[model samples]
Target chain A: MTAEIKWVFLYSLLTALATGLGALPFAFLRQVSTRGLALAESLAAGLMLGASFSLIAEGSHYGLTQTLTGGAFGGLLLLAGKRLLDGHDIQFGEIRGAGARRILLILAIMTLHSFSEGIAVGVSFGGGQKLATLITLAIAVHNIPEGLAISAVLRPQGASLLACAGWSIFSSLPQPLMAVPAFLFVETFQPVLPYGLGFAAGAMVLMVFLELLPEAYEKADSENVALWTTLALVAMVLFQTYL
Target chain B: MSSTPILSLLVAASVAALATTLGTIPLSFDLKAKRRALSAAYSVAAGIMIGAGYLLTLAGLESRPSACILGAVLGSTYSFWLRRVTGSKKFDDNDLESIPVEPKEVDRFLLQSSFHSAAEGAAIGAAAAVALPLGLFLAAALAVHNIGEGMVLTHRLYSPQATSSHPNAVPAPLLWPTSLPPAALVVVTKLPQIVLAMGTYFLIQVWPEFLPLALGFTAGALFFLTLTDLTPFAYGQGRREWVALLCSAAAALVVLGQSFFL
Candidate 1:
């Protein structure tokens, strides 16, 4: 293998593994308290909300014309998917298990967003070694909380520690797969990056306001929730100091 | 130049994927957190999500006012419509304390969780293509959030029905929707991120220009979620003003401060 390719792949691998490393904490805890669950949710909420917005700011590189167009398109896509699921047109009995179907539909949407990260890894390599190294480092550090986020929701749903780790890793598989190809043709792929970035950003934003935060609110009290959320945002933002 | 860059890219991506799975390994130990702790974690996660949307997604669009407005409006509007279509209701905050939940609701919740995870993975992938710095930031932020996710998902299985320690802990009132065992259901719900990660990455390389629309689309969807999905629940549960004001203020300050300083 070429030295450059070797380093790029190695860095990506390390980054991906960091996600599993983040999962280690859940293995020790056999049970959780109501208070603990709330705390965990708040933390995840903070991290996710922050990241989603950060993505938007980054996407602004292209000007609002692209941003709004991309964002609006993303929103429509989600609605289309949601409507399909919520359409409730199909009788529950017709689908073998409506629950599984619903789960699958959600999975499809999740996949739409994840594919972009893999491309990001690939694209960063095009920026050259120094830039790639920095990007890799950032992504690796970032995966830890992502791992935690997955475990946060799944653990409460009754998933095992191993399962949470496995799923968390599973969600991030795109990074390595796309890195190779994106590195091969940087110029060709450059133009589309903003739109893809915007799409992911929009989807996640909706997720926070629509899915995660509400869930957290339902789980935690309306009173202490904001404080916990603030703490998490502050913690995650701390990493930016290194930038 | 021993070989093509391809070799290195493959390895890098693989390790990144491994990190995600490895992070979950800790859940096997005997340690545990309480309900309040989980709530704290979720709250943190929520904050992170809000910060990410504004800082990365929304702010990135500042230059293009038209696109930004379009994305915001569409996202919020569609989400509103979706809620109506889904039959999902925001339980009044007044009744949040007394509301009953069942296994079916849990299943639905699991499904939704998977959806978001997949979407997040895609965000990272998309960011990588456009701006390495942005991608790095998003990825780092998400990794931190995932740790809590690992713990929270494990906590979801605990039921008041299964335990005698907390009498006041209400047993879930909503019926579990399917015949599938909880364990299996959990696995099914959690496995999609890998596919999403890989798929999104691959797609971006092949269809580069699509990213703008794609990114904007994600923003719109998220906006919708915020409007339809999270806001109601948040408003209903707490003193709306405090919850809205504090969280929004904190998130905004963090992003704006970074914009100037960073």
Candidate 2:
């Protein structure tokens, strides 16, 4: 196998193991209060804000008209997606007690989310090395919460720990699955590279506004949310300077 | 042994990694006060990102408008496809409230979020790895941004309840767990993404012909983020709409200024 393939295998294995092992912490923490949860949510909001600014803004430096046009296109696409999927539903995996339609809907939503993440990974790789590592790390950090969210949803449905683990693993399967292929033969797929990156960026931007930020507002006080957001920005600045 | 290229790449990668890690530190705090602090941080980071994109990516690829348009179209189309395939679910207050306290579930959430962040980091690293000085600068900026993201995410998972009870709490001392499984997971998953990102950079490094395309692709990603994510998030709530707009404008201006002055 090529050196690149070896790296891909290692990454995929590590990600799966980390995700599975990460789940163990919750068992010990037991119960977290609602107040605590809100605080955490706010923080997450801030971090996303910082990330969006630092990564996306930096991305724009490549070109003005082109970047702006691309951004506009991406925004419109997200809006379109929201409109199309507004009331639609689908399902996947093993269905417990929920109707087949509901299960399908859940699965579909999960797939959509995961696919966006996969695209992000693919795009980040376009940058190569350090940039890719940064993107991967950021995505991985964020995935922990996503895994928790998925587990919470599945737990009520009589899903076992192993099952939850499986789902969590499945949810992120697209990241490495996509990354490895993209990396191994980026030359062959050169034509679509820019578009793929753009798609991922657009999707991520949409996710932050449509999902993450709104959730932050719902859970935390306005002031607290604002503060966390600011901190997130500061953190970004500091990281840039120090790193 | 003129290893300037490799040396610079290492510098860029390390810097990117550190920035992302540092940015994520505040996220571990589970306090309401800390959350607000994190939000403010995000706004600033957003400013930096917007500025960087305009100054670096846009300036570098000014020759290729068509590629940029194409990139954007592809991005939006993909997002549309995903949405069509899966219905959107709005997260409620109750969902947030139940986050931190719940056992085992939090771990999964953290892992997923971290994974996402790592992917972003990898992209930044790759950009730096290929472009050298220009990419390095962007990577540095992105590293800072990723750190903020990490802080925000960490705070979300740790203190979900703090927001609901004290909407106006003062910023508190932020403390992150030194040995969380999620953190380790984030670092581990980042390894390959970084490598792939570097490989991409290598390709670009070898063939200067691809610079325009690379720049265009990066521009597309940034542009999509600014218009779709940052702008909307800034304007989402009626109260923060103006602030968001101002921030967005300021961010753009910073880049404009850099283009002319820097």
Every candidate's fraction of true contacts kept comes to: 0.04, 0.00
lDDT of 1 at B104: 42
Residues A129-242 of candidate 2: C-alpha lDDT, one tens digit per residue = 677667666656655544554454444344566766677677667666666666666565444433333333444344444444455556554334444444443343334323
For model 1, the superposed segments whose C-alpha errors exceed 4 Å read A1-3, A62-64, A85-111, A240-243, B1-262
Summarize candidate 2's per-residue lDDT along B153-221 as a digit string, tens digits: 444444435445444222221222324543443454344435544665665567756554554344334
Residue B24, model 1: Cα distance from true site in angstroms: 53
Tell me the docking grade of candidate 1. Answer: incorrect
Candidate 1's error at B59, in angstroms? 11
TM-score of 2: 0.41
Predicted candidate 2, C-alpha RMSD: 19.1
The local lDDT score (0 to 100) that residue B68 gets in candidate 2 is 35
Question: Which candidate's lDDT is highest?
Answer: 1
TM values, all candidates: 0.48, 0.41
lDDT, candidate 1, B158-226, per-residue tens: 433322344422234343334544444444444454455445555757776455444544454443343
